[model samples]
Target: MSHTVTDDRQQQTHTPVALIGLAWTLVGVPLAYGLYNTVKAASALFSG
Candidate 1:
C-alpha cells in the first residue's frame, strides 16, 4: 500500500472564500451603498 502526506504551507495558497463573498456583495448590492458602509465602519473604527 502507498501513503501520501501534505505540507501545511501549501494549504495557504488557495484563495479565501470570504474575499470572494465580499466581492460578490460589492457587485450585487448598490455601489454607493456598499462603499458607504465599508468606509463608514472603517473610519469609525480607526478614527484616532
Candidate 2:
C-alpha cells in the first residue's frame, strides 16, 4: 500500500473588505445609534 501526502500551504485568499464593512454597518451602526439615543435621553431626564 502506498500513501500520498498533499501540501495545502499555498492557498490564495482575498480579504472580504466589503463584506466586513457591510457587516459592521448593519450591526455596529444601529448599536451606536441606540447607545447615543439612550445616553441623550438619560442626560435630558437627569438635567431637566
Candidate 3:
C-alpha cells in the first residue's frame, strides 16, 4: 500500500478592483438613495 500527500501553500484568491467597485455600486446606490429620500421626507415634517 502506498500513501500520497499533496501540499498547497501558495494558493491565493482575489477580487478585481473593478469588480469590487461594481459590487459597491450595486449595494450602495440604492442605500444612498433611500437615505436621501428619508432625510428629505424628515426635513419636510420639521420645516413646515
Candidate 4:
C-alpha cells in the first residue's frame, strides 16, 4: 500500500479596477448626497 499527498493552492478571481471604481461611484455618490442632506436638515432641527 502506498499513499500520495498533493499540495495545491486554489485559484482566486478578481474584480477589475475600473469595474470596482464604477460600482463605488454608482453607490457612493447617492449615499453621500443623502447623508449631506440629512445632516443639513438635522442641523436646522437642532438650531431651533
Best by lDDT: 4
Q: Against the unseen true structure, what C-alpha lDDT does each candidate score?
A: 0.87, 0.95, 0.96, 0.97
The C-alpha TM-scores of every prediction are: 0.36, 0.61, 0.73, 0.73
lDDT tens digits, residue span 4-32, model 1: 88676654477799999999887877987
CA deviation > 4 Å runs, candidate 1: 1-29
Prediction 3 global C-alpha lDDT: 0.96
Better of 1 and 4 by TM-score: 4
Superposed on all Cα atoms, model 2 deviates from the true structure by an RMSD in Å of 3.7
Better of 2 and 3 by lDDT: 3
Better of 1 and 4 by lDDT: 4
Alpha-carbon lDDT of model 4: 0.97
List of clashing residue pairs for candidate 2: none
Clash number for each model: 0, 0, 0, 0
Report the lDDT of model 4 for residue 32.
Answer: 100
Cα lDDT for residue 19, model 1? 97
Kindly list the per-residue Cα lDDT of model 3 for residues 1-48, writing each as its tens digit.
999987868878998999999999999999999999999999999996
Tell me which of candidates 2 and 4 scores higher on lDDT. Answer: 4
As a whole number from 0 to 100, the lDDT of residue 31 in candidate 4 is 100
